[model samples]
Target: MSEYHVPVLLGPSIDGLDIRPEGIYVDATFGGGGHAKEIAQRLDDKGHLFVFDQDEDAEANLWGATNVTLITSNFRHLTRWMKYYDVIGRVDGILADLGVSSHQFDDPSRGFSYRYDEPLDMRMNRQQLLSAADVINQYDAVQLQDIFRSTEK
Candidate 1:
């Protein structure tokens, strides 16, 4: 596990899933694979889990899992990609723990925090073109305010 990463609401989240051994599950936010690991442990050989993380670094966490499918893509494309993987209609459970991870906040270069003075680069998907810097520097003040208000609600 990365020193900066920590799973949140892990026990309660897994318990709420009410996992079925033969079912297929999806973890939309596979930050450090903490929750995915726990879910995998409870799954039988027939069970399947598709983990999605836009970050390429997440692949490093997929060492020993046998029945897992890791997708290096944003969760917004979950339905589309699940269908591509032949798991759209067969999905038995879906778990999405949304929001930024602890590591993102701790890493000063990621620019997710206001606590540190760094170049604003809060692209959860590093491959994406629109980052926090782009939003702040390019968007008009009204647009920025609108985004902030919408996200707050």
Candidate 2:
């Protein structure tokens, strides 16, 4: 477990994966690499794990694992990238921990925790143009309500 962000349900989640030592897998949300590290350990040289995270901060937690490939991009584009890597149809398992990590919540600079006063920037990817401040300031009442109501893309 990383001090940066501890993984939730570590044992059961890996058991649920039913990972094959030689199988290919995907870690869709590699926050602090807690899950990714576990997945990588379960794989052999023949096996591979493609890990994805939109936040550049995730790169800091990457351990030197030979069987893992870290892709610094959103998992929403999984198909396109998987096709590019020629593992589109061969993936055996995928693990996605969608909850915000401890690191993100604890970092006052990220503006996620209310314990400390900071800028209202809650962007997962700092490179993105739109931000929490922009949305709150620019969006109208109806627009904000619509966003709050719908979870679908």
Candidate 3:
């Protein structure tokens, strides 16, 4: 595992998959490729692995020699990417390790964790324009109210 992010609950999480040697799998959030590496290990030469991650930094940790397809997009659009890649319903298993990675939480510049008093820029994809700063400083009263109200229930 890369120092960028150490995958939590590594063994139990991967073991729970009950991986098949020739089955197709998806790692929805391939942070640091720790879990992905394990999944790849269990796969035979005919097996395939598809990894999805919105954050760009995570790409640096992916292995090039594996039969893994890395998609640079959020898992919310899993169906779209699956169809685009022709995987669709062919996937035998999926492993999603969600939430902020250690690299994002530990780094103050990412502005994800409250431990650091950095810029209020909490965007998973940096390409997006709406940030935490924009919500706090630019959103209208009605917009802010709607946001707060949604969390109340």
Local distance difference test, each candidate: 0.87, 0.90, 0.90
Instruction: Give the better candidate number (1 or 2) by TM-score.
Output: 2
lDDT of 1 by residue, 1-153 (tens): 556468888899999999998889999988888899889988999999999999886787785778899999988898899889887899888888888888788889899899899988988888888987887789998998899999898
**Tens digits of lDDT, candidate 2, 92-131:** 9999999777888888898777788887888888889887
Winner on lDDT between 1 and 2 is 2
When sorted by TM-score, best at the front, the candidate numbers are: 2, 3, 1
- In order of appearance, the predictions have TM-scores of 0.89, 0.95, 0.90
**Which residue runs does candidate 2 get wrong by more than 4 Å?**
none
Q: Write the per-residue lDDT of candidate 3 for residues 1-153, one digit (tens) a residue.
A: 589889889999999999999999999999899999999999999899999999988899877846898889999899998899887989999999978899888889899988998998888888898889989999999999999999899
- How much RMSD separates candidate 2 from the native structure? 1.4
| Candidate 3 deviant stretches above 4 angstroms | 148-153
Model 2's lDDT to the true fold? 0.90
- Which is the winner by TM-score between candidate 2 and candidate 3? 2
Q: Predicted candidate 3: what Cα RMSD to the true structure? A: 1.8
Worst 10 residues of 2 by lDDT: 111-120
